[model samples]
Target chain A: MHNKTVAELSKGLAAGSFSSVELTQHFLTRIAQQDPALNSFITVCNDEALADAKAADAKIASGSASPWTGIPFAHKDIFCTQGVKTSCGSKMLDNFIPPYDSTVTRNFKQQGAVCLGKTNMDEFAMGSSNESSYYGRVVNPWGENLVPGGSSGGSAAAVAARLTPAATATDTGGSIRQPAALCGVTGLKPTYGRVSRYGMIAFASSLDQGGPIARTAEDAAMMLNVMASYDDKDSTCIERDVPDYTSTLNNSIEGLNIGLPKEFFSDHLNANMQQQVENAVKELEKLGANIKEITLPHTELSVPAYYVIAPAECSANLSRFDGVRYGHRCADPKDLEDLYCRSRTEGFGDEVKRRIMVGAYALSAGYYDAYYRKAQQVRRLIKNDFTAAFNDVDLIVGPTSPTPAFGFNSKGDDPVKMYLEDIFTISTNLAGLPGMSIPGGMIDNLPVGLQLIGNYFDEARLLNVSHQFQQATDWHTKTPKGFE
Target chain B: MSIKREDAENIARLAKLQISDEQLEKITGDLSNILSLVDQLKAANTQDIEPMAHPMDAVQRLRPDHITETDNREAFQKIAPATEEGLYLVPKVIE
Candidate 1:
């Protein structure tokens, strides 16, 4: 199972070549030694992981096993695990252990996959950079001075640095893809409602969806197989059947029509990013794929509409954490107002509170129709633009982010500058389509990512294309200079 | 449309956040920049546009309103600041 994909690992486990405890121990050693400087993990459940691994071994011995049995994976901290600390990267939840497992976590555990630990994230999934975590900023495992893109930085960094085979991550806006791009890993955000969010901490709920991150698309496909399910617990969960994602890996991309949106190549895009993505497309062309320029005219308006809509939803969702129920509370309060003011002020980071205020203002009594309603209308137009593009192309390709990973203090003192990093990624969420980021090319040695977007419920096709690319190039297999 | 300091603070209060006097000034400037960008969305003609909240207009696939979910109120409430008689406790405002 050492050099094998998750499919191979599962086959070997079923065939009794390697026990679950042995597999879990190898990863634990790597994480213990490597995660200290990377700060990828906030909590490593060493004892619990071993116990789960032993149980998985027993299940396999009793002839009760599945493809996910004995697979070791880490979960993002935002998902609540029963009896495990579920801090969504805030001091408010730093000590808060949950009594219930999130639907995603429970699904993996039911399949007998051992949870290694909770990975770090941007506080409440609000930051474009990993620096917003309450624990401390996570550094890109590629370079010491570079920042790992966020708010799923921990999951990306852990996978890229070989601390874990794969990890579970959520995207609201570009939390999953941006970090996956910056840290040089593979991540997919399934179509909205494709995964259950029952135990996930609320963050821009309308845009949030969870998927997998790993070194290669094949590993991601296997994890996606287990992660996707129709859950009755989450009202938004899709009723569609989950497909065998790995079944399509051998499908050829010959004559596959790929759309390159003109708006993605606007002057606002950094020249270097555009060049690297072009190179990646050229490589795909060599593999028999046909690339075509398509128009997604409403792309430019996505950022503005997203900022307004996302924050507006955030304001309503975050109202639950009033310090009276289940989060941090002020030391002393003379009234309920004082209690709320002090608790929220002390509880949230700058960016989260900034969004809450923006959301509240947009949704306020007078501005609701003007700002919030208008934003929703534009969101529909954005989704329509994508629908129009799919009529001509099987997948849409572009730079996952505008540029490569930035320095530790890059984009500092300017929030808008940081928000632009998610420009290309946000529209996919707006359109409610599946999106994946694959290791594309390098800019000044830091990895850049190429994004592939599929029509709704087209995750299997997206995975097939990414797997073909990984098989052709050694980019996904190459680790950073120092990390290895 | 640069935001005024008073307007910024007013919004802050409405949002229930405490911004210090000095923080209000910086926040005012920041809000101005963001709003200037956000204002661009209003230029599009969307009179006939329908507001979309989801991909489909189908009825929500809700679980039967039965007690499929248990209230581990005692377990969950262990993390709350105050709980009494199975209800979350808070300051009384209508004394």
Candidate 2:
């Protein structure tokens, strides 16, 4: 039962082989036993999960169940869950219990999916490693010493360990893909505005987009169907109809042109990891896809531009967390200024403060033209590069991360070295394109991810490409030693 | 591109975060390192390029001005640190 994909689980529920209560209990028990080692979950809603599961059982009995009805899935702590603590992996909101559901949570509820709990993440979605989380770092299921790539690390780790069949996650710069690469799971980030950001906490508004991390591309597509929708509450949610992503998973890829950026395989990438990705490409070619060498000329500038733009937006978004409203407040204050300063300093973690300070500096009086405006200009060039490349290629293929998961604490002190972990996945977010990370193979007993970047709103094609490759390879099926 | 201790202090003040002397020294070094890394953006030529604030050129969607939300202040204020008589309590801002 634990090994089944989401489709299989839904089938079982429909067949009366097991009730939703039984399935939810199975996962809850596994989490109780296995999660002590991984620390992937921030809060477990035991009573709420059982109640939702019981409700799902009622829906199943009524013969009106959707594919997701009675399915148990985890939500990253970033999404606000009504009456449950949505911590965002930060102490600032540890005591917060959202009075209302975020649009994402509301959608899952409408479809009758059971919420298992909120998963841990980096503080405010700021770091590539989960070490910055106030709840403590999440350990990689493959090796306890290695860091789970973040700020979606907990969701990726849980899916890989089979704690849940699937979980909701977000990508800002490479939050979803990088973690999925390290944990050996399937993850996707849709085009910006394709999903609503109404209730999810903001990190960088333009770069942040919500998607899913699951065991297979088909499973991810199923989750995406429920997650993507337009909401008036979120002004940026695109007013476009979403197609059924699963409808095209079996589409033929014969003569499909895939661009391989030379820059993606350069010295920044590890030699052995390169071999694994190349092997994955070979498998795709055998499935009748055509591979071509291409160039995204301004690839190196993405990191620098992202650093400036993300922080500048974050600084403005986070200003609402003053001592007066909802969130942590200082114990004693000398005045209003002290109240604001002390509360924020006490509430946020080091990484959050570092970003806030950097953001403030970037948008400061004298530095605006040199840093913020210049980064935006460079961003245009990066987007243009993708626009030019997509004219000839149906999709872009590359390694998701330069290397497999690094050991925990390896890059903690050096922020710049840590930023480089996202070198491959950032440009897609900058250009507001859809991207997915599928398991390629293993290197040094760790997993490597093959990334697929599609033209705007071309998620169906991306899912089809991923599903086809998954059929020819078994990388996504491999599980960690102890967890399996 | 090196950030000074005083610069970090000023940034912290502007960002509304309190910093200790110890935090000031460490933050200065970290800020300097990050800024230096971002300084690589100077290599790109953008004399005639247009700046992109959003990924897509989206304009703010405006609806007819009307009452769209029912007041939920009571439910929202339940999580406030200090509230009194349906109003958020804050340090004195008036004389």
Candidate 3:
């Protein structure tokens, strides 16, 4: 039961092989057994899950079931779940119980999908490694000592560990793709505004997009079918119609033009990691993709630009946690300033604070033009690079991270070294394009993710290509030894 | 691009985060390192390029001003630390 993908589980539920309550319990038991070691979940809603499962069971019996009915999944703590704690992996939100559901949560509830719990993440979706999580660092299920690449690390790790069939995750800057790569799973970051962001905690509004992390690309497509929707509540959510993502998963890739950015294969990427991505490309080529080397000249500038831009926006967005309305508040305060300062200082973790300070500095009086505006201009250059590349290619492919997951704390002290972990995937977010990371291969016993970047609103094609790649290879099917 | 301790302190203040003197030193160093990394953006020729504040070029969609929300003040304020008579309580701002 734990080994089945969401698609398989949905079929099993439709056939009544096992009741939704039984399926939900099976995953809850696995999480209870396995999550202690991985630290993947912050809140496991056993009671709520059982109740939802019972309701789903009735829906399935009545034959009024959507594909997601009776299926169990996890939500990254960033999404607000009514009456459940949506911590966002920070002390700031640890006490927050949203009065209403996020759009993503509401959609899943409407589909009657049973949610197991909220997965851990880097505090406020701010770090590359899950270590920044106030709950605790989530261990990569692949290896005990290796860090699970993050912000969405717990979601990726949980899916890798089979605690849930699929989990909802968001990517600000490689949060979904990098962690999915490290944990040896499939994850997607949809085009900006492709999914509604209302009630999904804000990090970097421009770069943040919610998607799915799952064991297979087909499963990810199924999850996207439910996750992608337009809502007036989220002003940034595109008003365009969303296609059924799963409908295109089996589409042929014959004569598909795939671009490999020359800069992505440079010395910056590990040699062995490059080989794995090249192998995935070869497999794609066998599936009828025509591989060509293209240039995204501004690739190297993405990380620098992202640092300035993300923190700048975050400083403004995070200002809402001032202790006056909600979230962590100090015991006593002398004045309004004291309440604001102490509450925020205590609520946020070091990485969160560091970003806030950097953001404040970038948007400061004299530095605004030099830092904030300059980074935005560079962002345009980065987006233009993708626009030009798409003229000759159907999609771009590259290694998701420079390397596989590194040892815990390896790059912790050096912020820049940590930032570069997202070097390859950050540009996609900058361009507001859809990107998917599928298990490419293993390097040094850890998984390597091959990233697929689609042109704006081309998630259907990306899902199709990823599904075809999975069919040609067993990389996506391999599970960690202990979990299996 | 290096950040001074005073600058870091000032930034923390502006951000409304109280940083102790001990953490300030380390934070200042980290900020300097991050700044140096972003400083590379200076080399890029972005002349005449408009800053992209949002990914999409869409303008803000304005709707007719009308009440769309139900009263949920009690439910929302339930999570607040201190509330009295439907008003959020905070530190004294006026004498």
Candidate 4:
């Protein structure tokens, strides 16, 4: 169960190799025994998962099963799951049970997929490393002393450890791709609004998008099929057609034009990372891709622009978490102001509060033009660079993150250094293009990820290209020593 | 663009989040680090460029205000720390 892909598991279930109940039970026992050390799961949905697994078994028995009918997966704790604890790694929402389910989770449930549990994340999806989570940091399964890239660290770690076949993840400024890069798993951030963000807790509205984390490109593609849909409930969801992602897994990439952004290979990138990404590019070239050099002139401005836009939006979206409505409230406050203050002071962590302050200042009356508005304008130019580049090329390639997984306390007490980790990934989010991270060769035994960015709604091509690369390399299949 | 303790407190007050002096000191340091990056964006040239709010041109599609959901309020509130008279209990206001 641990090493099998979603396609293999689904085939086994349909062919009477084993029932969904057995698979679910196997994963549950493994999670119960192993998750304590990794701290990957914040809440395990045992009862709900078992019930769904039994239903999936019935579907297989009746010859009416979906492709992923019995496969078990987990979600980042940020998604609102009905009757399940959906704490977004916050002390405030520690006991908050949402009345409704997030569109992503609901879609999974509708597919008869078994739920494993809720994985941990940085508090309110705020940090680059997972340390800001109130539930505690998620350690890398490969090396417990190293950090699992976050705020989607738990999802990445869970998939890397083979605790689940795949996990649902959200990326705002590299949350999904960065962690997957560090963990050596395949993760994708579909075009913004490709997957509805209806009941998913807001981080930064414009930048927040959901996608998948799995062991291989094929598994990610299958999960993408289940997750991609237009939900009227999500006001921002695009009303467009979703392609059959799995069908394109074997699509030929004979003439695919792959662009290498020259700015990404500069001296600032670590020597080891440059080597790994360059080697991965060579492999793609061997697969018959038409490789060429391209320049994104606005690459250097992404970090600064993102800090302004994301925090400003975060400041606004997070305002709803006042003590009055839902989540945490302080005890015995004298007035409204006191209640709001005490609740927030108690609720948010160090990283969340830092963003709120920065966001509030940027969105404030006097500073709005200098910070927020200017960032938005530059953001447009950044997107334009990609738009123009795509007209000349089919896809772009870069290092997913600047470096591999660093030590647990590597960037200690320095927020700016941590922010630089997403430099390659933030621009894709800014441009609203589909992006994926395929496992490149390791750097000093730590996994590195090669990033692929495609034209808008071209997730099928991105998956096809990644699938071809995975077929040629064993990096995606190489699991950590102890976990296997 | 460096944030000070007073600046953090003022922003906290504006955002309606309460904070203590000790918390303000640490938040000031962290915000200063973040804002230094924001300061770079503020320096960029955007004299006549229009700000892009969203990447898509699709208008917001709202679900009908009708209840397409279950009446799970009772089940939802079951986990709340305090409740009274079929509503969530919170710190009282208005003398």
Which candidate has the top score in DockQ? 2
Clash pairs (backbone) in predicted model 1: none
What DockQ do the predictions score, one after another? 0.71, 0.88, 0.87, 0.62
Off by over 4 Å in 2: none
Which candidate has the highest lDDT of all? Answer: 2
Would you list the C-alpha lDDT of every candidate in the order shown? 0.88, 0.94, 0.93, 0.89
lDDT order, best first, reads 2, 3, 4, 1
For residues A1-484, what per-residue lDDT tens digits would candidate 2 score against the true structure?
7899998999999999999999999999999999999999999988999999999999999999999999999999999999999889988998999999989999999999999999999999999889999999999999999998999999999999999999999999999999999999999999999889989999999899999999999999999999999899999888999899999999999999999999999999978988999999999999999999999999999999999999999999999888788988899787889889888988899989989889999999999999999999999999999999999999999999999999988985868899999999999999999999999999877989999999999999999999999998999999998988
Q: In angstroms, how far off is B42's CA in candidate 2? A: 0.6
Candidate 3 residues A1-484, lDDT tens each? Answer: 9999999999999999999999999999999999999999999999999999999999999999999998999999999999999999999988999999999999999999999999999999988889999999999999999889998999999999999999999999999999999999999999999999999999999889999999998899898988999898998889989898888888899999999999999998878988888888999999988999999999999999999999999999999999988899988888988999999989999989999888999999998999999999999999999989999999999999998989998985888899998899999999899999999999877898999999999999989999998889999888888999
- Tens-place lDDT digits, model 1, residues A392-419: 9999999898878888778978787887
Candidate 2 lDDT (Cα, 0 to 1): 0.94
- Real contacts retained, model 4: 0.69
Candidate with the larger lDDT of 2 and 3:
2
Docking class of 2: high
Error of model 1, residue A83, in angstroms: 0.9
**Alpha-carbon interface RMSD for all candidates, in angstroms:** 1.4, 0.9, 0.9, 2.0
